[model samples]
Target chain A: MRSVVSILDLSTSEINELMNVADDIERNPEFYRSKCKHKILATIFYEPSTRTRLSFESAMLSLGGSVISTPDSKISSAAKGESISDTVRVISNYADIIVMRHPKEGAPVVAAMKATVPLINAGDGGHFHPTQTLADILTIRRTKKTLSGLTIGLCGDLMFGRTVHSLIEAMLRYPDNKYIMISPNELKLPEYMREALDKAGVSWRETESLETAMPELDVLYMTRVQKERFFNEEDYVRLKDVYILDRDKLKTAKSDLAILHPLPRVNEISVAVDDDPRAQYFYQTLCGKQMRMALIMLLLGII
Target chain B: MNIDGVNNGIVLDHIKAGESMLVYDYLKLGRLKCCVAIIQNCQSKKMGLKDIVKIDELIDIDLDVLGYIDPHITVNYVKDGKLLKKRHLALPETLTNVIKCKNPRCITSTEQELPHVFKLIDREKQIYRCAYCDVVGDNK
Candidate 1:
């Protein structure tokens, strides 16, 4: 069975195909209303996440599919000490497809190894979040019309943001997609990421100032400074408020720039910017559902 | 100094000087009951100095660990005091339970039964990344 543990699992052509399906789903929701009539999706969140879990549930329900979920690991069999392998093995019998989020990195990989059905990694600890990358790309495709030749400005926590990492990997597959990585010195992109960009021969530059990179970008992807990812509370507190995107900051940004945040955002993006048409983060949520629906259908081989 | 050749055994040659002890530790040579000789700092022409390990039994050793430690090392299988086959080494594609991941957030760290796995991502740099957390790890 196919399992999406990372963004690299899907080829560029496959991603484009999935996006095409997502676009069709967005335009004609009634056509896909009962596409997954009898299928059951298992949503297992080992970590407490409001947006991703709910998004998966909503996507399944919208497709006329049933969902069985364990939204909180604290109250599930995990709290009593069950391995991801055993849980997935059991869940596979009950569900046709599985989507999981875990605080431990590569937890879904373990689940994927044991699952009989298709497995989707919703999110993993400070690692890959392939679904969010799908959503970001879909949003970009909707507004920008092409995945290539755009200046993508990544702001806030580049170091520990799984969404940022996943997005960069996805975008690297396209041609001429320059990256302007804007983050504080302490939260700069990891050395491996820099090496990857250098190896790929992509145009990428790192800067401390978000405002400086704002004018050059076609897409500005903002990220939250997650408290859970930091080993030190002091570091999290110091960096959490470092890059707040208020309306004043947007004044220097391109009018056509699409602002995105893989959210449950905590003070990183200001409420004032929500009124701007350029702020597409909320709409990004809808894109997430559509892409997930497309992905579920593809993995289940129903479409 | 000279050591007796085993009738049926394996010989490890051309190990970089000062790394034989590491090879010994990694291969758990101390746990073996058979005769094992770790010859250190021997003369060499190809290399300035080298080490050799001679084992008195044809026991299976982890070639991946050996290759990761030093790819230049030569393995000679012996049967009845005659050389059977010579094996060369290269960095392994994947290593299972060979090295533990230090990343605290990796699934292998908490899961006691999970095999610690690493994959060679960069052959030029000899870089191996943990399969779970994608953190760079050394052979040590």
Candidate 2:
């Protein structure tokens, strides 16, 4: 696909191909560093996601490319009545590609249509974050050596976690990937997600008990439930502390289990667990840069 | 009961009662120079209550739209005051520019060049999803 709007846009083979490229870059970062010399990447973030915005900028900069970013929509012409359509069109001339994150669900899709250059959706509301999922897939591929044949445990907010949504959709294409869904009843995985899994014929078990599912899991993807994403304050207050992963909780998990989180995590993951050998969320962030680098090259048809 | 039959126009029969006005407005029947007659709430043997429209001239009508709004409608073509063809309506497999994609992230919202289109993914459930955003659209 010319534009990366959704993870599903890339076929399984294409995603596998990207994984290979990410592996190569992860091993030999220097070789790909100068690949995008003189090229420009524009990151337009309508929503303030520091990690995502910075990752895109770092990915571009590491590739010897320059970045021209409108980090905040309010700071950009959008505040002065400019639409995302016009903004993307204007930036298309200035940049080789665009990475966008917007509060509106389809804002990036709209920008993509108007862009002359390739577009990457960083994260569109609760819609999709193909890049982060790329980072996720890369981390999984690197750590586990395969995208298939593992039981993945997705914990915490399944309702508003776009990462979980994209990752589940991406991973289900593989063979024999079981999902252990751990969430409070209030924050259960949405019906549409269940329908997708069911439609794919993937076997998944749901439980409120993460400890019971921890031993069987190869990977535990913990997510934070932001108060803003929750509609009702009372529900948020009750469920936000529902799944706090401490060292005690990690004791139940397998020794080789990879713990993943799409971060800026609140209290979901304990700060005390950061030094644990299995806690790979930091590596996940660095892997995010590599994946974005590989992704930039792949999307630009460089590799 | 004394309404005159059409000479060369189309007759829409078996439209659900109280819904013919929607079809009438949607088809832009008022824009047509031909005489148009909307007979609403007419008693029918099969439908119990139905609406009918008789036109003086055969104007362009979106038959798919007629089916989408009220699938039970039947269209009859009149030629020189004679019955020409009778067409039964069925639900369209897809609809274009009918339901707006509510998902703000959808491509069509900003891409003015793109047409708002939806495909019927589940016939049994009558579920339609936007081609771009995958936002579900109601059958109605």
Q: lDDT at A48 for candidate 1? A: 84
Please give the TM-score for the first chain of candidate 1.
Answer: 0.98
The candidate scoring highest on TM-score is 1
lDDT of 1 by residue, A157-197 (tens): 99989999999999999999999999999989987788889
How many clashes in each structure? 0, 5
Error of 1 at A270 (Å): 1.3
B40-76, model 2: which lDDT tens digit per residue? 9899999899999888887777887887787789999
Query: Highest lDDT: which candidate?
Result: 1
CA lDDT, every model vs. true structure: 0.92, 0.85
Residue A274 displacement in candidate 2 (angstroms) = 1.8
Q: How many angstroms is residue A208 displaced in model 1 relative to the true structure, after the best TM-score fit?
A: 1.0
Question: DockQ scores for all the models shown?
Answer: 0.80, 0.36
Identify the runs in model 1 with alpha carbons over 4 angstroms from their true place.
Answer: none
Listed per model, the TM-scores of chain A against the true chain A are: 0.98, 0.97
**Candidate 1: lDDT of A74?**
90
